[model samples]
Target: MKLAIMQPYFFPYIGYFQLIHAVDRFIVYDNIKYTKKGWINRNRMLRDGKDVIFTLPLKAAPDSLDICERSLSADFDRNKLLNQLHGAYRRAPFFSDAFPVLEQAIRFPNDNLFSFVFNSITGICDYLDIKTEFTISSEMAIDHNLKGQAKVLALCEKASADVYVNAIGGIELYPRDAFAARDIELKFVKSKPVEYVQFGAEFVPWLSIADVIMFNSANEIQENMLGEYELV
Candidate 1:
């Protein structure tokens, strides 16, 4: 089966979805170290023609260690953030239909970044009608190496995966000969730009579906997804 592994990200970029569309099973590496400044708890969105970042705040503690094990800040007030998002996207064309879904997801009572991100993943899958099974590496019998080829090979063994597909970003980090030695074929995925009409006369690229949904109808959004990305 085709397997792809990635860290759980909060409303990740389009490349993240491309990986999901390419694989049979997706393994989220939530058991790994938590990155303090990555997309684990934030993502970019378009706001009034400018790029804005939305984040889920985490409470810091003296002993905060693992990213996978870390929880959202205890002081996080869900309703307040929901209000902010609503105000930010209220005028979006698809807001009426998309807001409730996003609001309900953001209201989930969880403290971990993984829980938040996983909820977003499920929401997006539901929105886009994707049906791929997702697994957590920590819950699986995966190997424990975290460096370079060994890490990739270990994850493959854990999933019993024959063909391993990953984001194109890992091309330099992994050596092809190493995966070949272990009888596993490796391939990379790249996301092509999808264009859609927003509120203006011009088409925009790389804006999140949230941006499109707020400014366009679901039918138009679905129609815009006609473009396809590639598995390199």
Candidate 2:
């Protein structure tokens, strides 16, 4: 089996999904420490012809807390967030078809941070017709203290993966020889440049998957998912 693992992200860019789709199993690394500056609770979206950041408010926790232990702030207004997304993309070509998926994900009654983000990832995968199996790191039996490449290797071993795929950014992080010693092939996926019409503006790249969905049909998006990456 081919496997890939990544921290859960809220409506991440297309490259994130490309990694998931490129693998036979995708693992959501939820047991790791939560980073405030990370894309865990926030992501970029296109607004006014430019990229804008949006975030979900979380209840206060120690800096060392795992993502699975974090919770959404009780005062966070989900509807208001949905309204912001609506105002930003309501006029896009496929907004009507995409907004409901966004709404269903954001309104998913769970307040636990990891659960919410996991749901959103799976929800979007379903919309895009991605059928890759998913595994949660916290629920797995691997040693939780392993870090970096060791942790990744453990997960791959646990999943019986002969080929491990990661996003291109991980090229510097994972040593090629280490995976080779273990009889597992390591490869990185780089997304091919993707461009589509954005109403009344020059194309903005690397916005959230939600932005791509708003402007493109499911078939078009799926084609992008299938053809948008090259493994190296």
- Give the Cα-based TM-score of candidate 1 against the true structure: 0.88
Each model's TM-score, in the order given?
0.88, 0.98
Candidate 2 accuracy as lDDT = 0.93
* Local accuracy of candidate 1 as per-residue lDDT tens digits, 41-73: 877676666677778888774444555667788
- Residue clash pairs of candidate 2: none
Give me the candidate number with maximum TM-score. 2
Task: Quantify all predictions' global Cα lDDT against the true fold.
Answer: 0.74, 0.93
User: What would the per-residue lDDT of candidate 2 be over residues 17-60, giving only the tens digit for each residue?
Assistant: 99999999999988999998989999999889889999999998
